[model samples]
Target: MKIYVVGIGAGSADGMTFEARNVLEKADVIVGYTVYAELVKKLFPEKEYFVSAMKQEAERCRKAVEMAADGRNVAVVCSGDAGVYGMASLVYEIAASYENVEVSVVAGVSAMLSGGALVGAPLGHDFAVISLSDLLTPWEKIEKRLECASAADFAICLYNPSSKKRHDYLMRACDIMLKHKNADTVCAVAKNIGRDGEEYAIMSLAELRNYSADMFTTVFIGNSMTKNIGGKMVTPRGYKNV
Candidate 1:
């Protein structure tokens, strides 16, 4: 009974890691959020798929564990790295009760990495990855993280920046960062990364506050040392003058 937690990477087959593809191909059952499952389906349509709605992560992982315990090789798929705000932890938690199941995690390119590439090397130095979704986390905690990351001058990558229910969350997050960062600090929004209609834009912290983002958008806020080099957002790693 082996269960693989696979990261599919940015909703495109091109972005998937070799290890992730291999695990998905070998699995008898594929389980994930409906959107993620559909992405995997495009690559491996013959495999059995089990999909659930949003906010059903626990239920989904438990079902995957059950299927694994039934002697089926199962792969629980997620967009981006499964360990990063994905289904890996929940799968492991559920598999703990199933003594016969062995769990393996396959890494994939996360949005921060993919989005960063689209906008040059904005994350060349120290950075923080935070999620603005307050469903599982408290708003105060997210605000505090934004404040701390901004104050520390770390480039910040934000996941789940906005959704229909949380329309103003990204703006509020920007306000927090503005408290510590200059208005002209470089910032960017990477939308639909690796998928169709992919678009990205570079701007200042002040401009980003007025921008609109959705669930598919990943936001990047550059640190104090960041700058626009030839129209690309870049952060210096202090390797010069060596």
Candidate 2:
């Protein structure tokens, strides 16, 4: 049996890659976390769904792998690319014990790419993607990554910037970046990318320090080379000088 770990980009039918859509369509069962399952249900209602709540990732992957070993085509869905903070790796880890199941990953667009375009092209050059969520990782590591990314002058994309429990996480992140980045450095936020009521906020690092952000927002911090082109956040790759 083939088990496909799929990334349904941006939680929108329009945002899904053709390969991702095709795999979902071919699967007999779809398994995912509740929130991600809801997104897939809208696009493929006919398929049988097996959903679990958050923080039950291990059990969820085990169940999906067990089902696949029973000779059924199963697809496990994630919000963005399956490998990027997604269930792709976990699925493989669980599937290891079950030799009968074959696993394949179907990639999808991640928020960094989608959000990067929404606020122009902050990702035009090299960049680092970091998640501020301390659920699995410690905050100290997050701080170290921010400092390194900032000092290296790499355009940075941050995920899970803030939430009810992390109301000031974004602000703290900005403060760390500010140690190496300038106050005037351009920064932007892409809120609810590719979904309804989507919006963006572009500002300097100083303004971003006090900005209100949430889990739905993807934050961007530009390097020294990044600037505003018109009203959009942009980081040039030196094409004009060539």
Candidate 3:
């Protein structure tokens, strides 16, 4: 039995990769978080689905693996690239016990890519993608990463910027980065990326520290050379020739 871990990408057909779409289409069952389940149900309403709540990743993967072993073609769906903070790794870990099951991963555009496009090319040079949520990682570890990425001059992309309970996580991260980065360093926030109500704003690192954000927002802090070129948040690649 084989199972596909598919990245749905921004919860839209336009954002999903062709291979991801094909895998989902050919699968007999689709499994994912509740939000992702709803997103794909619109594209493939005829298929059966199994949805789990947030923080239920282990149980979710177990359910998907079980279905695949039952002679069902199962597709475990996730938003953005399956390998990037998605369920692909968990699936592999859980599927190791079942020698009969095969796992395949289908990649798609991650929020870093989709959201970066919305605000121009904030990732034109080296960059780092870090999640502000300490759900699985400790806050101290997250702080060290932010400080190091900033000191290394990598444009930084942030995920899970904020939630009701962790409202100040993004701001705290900014404070850490600011210790290495400039207060005037360029930054941007892209919300609802590749979906309705899509919007983005370019601002200074100082301004972003006070900016309101949510779980749906993807934050981008530029390297020292980043600039606001005609309303675009671009990090120059230093071509010299332009």
- List per-prediction Cα lDDT, in the order shown: 0.92, 0.91, 0.93
lDDT of 3 at 184: 94
TM-score for each predicted model, relative to the true structure: 0.97, 0.96, 0.98
Candidate 1 segments exceeding 4 Å error: 239-242
After superposition on all CA atoms, how large is the RMSD of candidate 1? Answer: 1.1
* 2 against 3, candidate with superior lDDT: 3
**How far is 28's C-alpha from truth in model 3 (Å)?**
0.5
Q: Estimate, for each residue in 1-242, the C-alpha lDDT of model 3 and write its tens digit.
A: 99999988986689998898899889999999998999999999999999989999999999899989889999999999999999999999999999889999999889999999999999999899999989899988999999899889899999999999999888899899899999999999999987889999999999999998999999999999999998889998874637
**Ranking of predictions according to TM-score:** 3, 1, 2
Itemize residue pairs with steric clashes in candidate 1. Answer: none
Residue-wise lDDT of candidate 1 within 1-242, one digit each (tens)?
88999989988798998889988888898999998999999999898899999999999899999999999999999899989998888888889999999999999899999999999998999999999999999999999999999999999999999999999998999999999999999998899999989999999999999999989999999998898988789988874622
C-alpha RMSD (angstroms) for model 2: 1.4
Once fitted onto the true fold, the runs of candidate 2 whose alpha carbons sit more than 4 angstroms away are: 239-242
Ranking by lDDT: 3, 1, 2
